[model samples]
Target: MLTKTEVVIGMTFLVLALLAISVLAVLASTCLVYPIAIDYFGIDQLTGLSRGELIKNYSVLMAYLTRPWVNDLVMPYFRASREGLIHFAEVRRLLLFSQLVAISCLAFTGFWLKRLQGLGQLHHLKRWLLNTCAILLAFCGLIACDFSRAFILFHRLFFQNNYWIFDPRFDPVILALPQGFFAWCAGLAVFYLLGQLILLYIFSIYKEGQAL
Candidate 1:
């Protein structure tokens, strides 16, 4: 049997892994949705850029966000103020942090799971999944209710400055990327997280029943 401390540590690792995976999912969805959102929302017309130009610039932005070595964001058609650039830099750091957390927690969770399996305690994972799912569902619901406020709150929580508030005159890229696009990204992330957790929950139940 596991001690209380061991069980708590295991659950903490599981929860962190789940949250990090969700963050990664949202970032991936953000990249994938850029082109679709641009076309669907008539961003080209709004920004006075051709479809190809918009895609090219947006691609550069996404590449900068994902690649650690790319230190500067150079969009051909868009210019960013110092504050906007700083905000993007901060976003890149946050993404890298989330990726690292996901990798480390997942690796640790693997060993923890192996230990649990040896002790016939793997079924305890189901409880962790259920509780995390409930919390994530509430978060998704809150975002769905008023995403604008949630978006601002998210920036405030993650960033120490107000650099995220971009001026359209300086950062035309914000015009291409609308709040609705982010809302879609959030929805996709929630979908991915919930589906993953529910599947794990079912598999855990199956494993428990099999041992009976």
Candidate 2:
């Protein structure tokens, strides 16, 4: 009963859903591991010490603190380390909650795509969905590249001598700019995608009436 164009659109939606789910998993893992690794490795304490002291005795601290290994390996360890611990439990709870929200969003989007496919309206889906997806993928890729640069820039601006810890006021403002920009872009993309889906639904209804 489905046409070739509808089938292609459905397949594309399914693929995008799968890819978004995978990205959610990766982000969740990263969020879980980063803090734990910082604590376990004592990166903050190490970095807090004078360079002379680090050079003289804790040379390994430089490698441990500055290396990409913390981002990749240590973060997950930090996430697992908090289990059964009373201290910093609130932070862990919040992290888990945040991850849940992100995963839930991805899951819901995937469900919507599935619903659209089931409605057999793929062929007439708005052009905006494809454009939005493409833009989102590109935006994410750009942010990934920018992340490293931002880290270095922040370090140079604020952390060259001081150990960067959570400062509620400045930290939130500094973090908000990049996150807010990305969120706005992603929101627009999702809006466009949803609009396309709506158009597809209308087209399907029109076609059905014509056949009747």
Give me the candidate number with maximum lDDT: 1
Please provide, for model 1 over 26-93, each residue's C-alpha lDDT reduced to its tens digit, 9 standing for 90 to 100.
77676567778888898998999998898899779888888788888998999899999999999999
| lDDT (Cα, tens digit) per residue for candidate 2, span 1-212 | 55677556655554455444443443434333434434545544644533233233222322233333432222211222222122123323433454455466557655655565567644444444465557756765675667556545644663333333333243321221233333433444444445544555576566546645
- List where candidate 2 sits over 4 angstroms from the true fold: 1-24, 27-94, 124-129, 141-145, 148-212
Candidate 1, residue 75: Cα displacement in angstroms equals: 0.8
Q: What TM-score against the true fold does each predicted structure earn?
A: 0.92, 0.30
lDDT of 2 at 80: 22
State the C-alpha lDDT per candidate.
0.84, 0.43
TM-score (C-alpha, index-matched) for candidate 2: 0.30
The C-alpha stretches of model 1 lying farther than 4 A from their native spots are 209-212
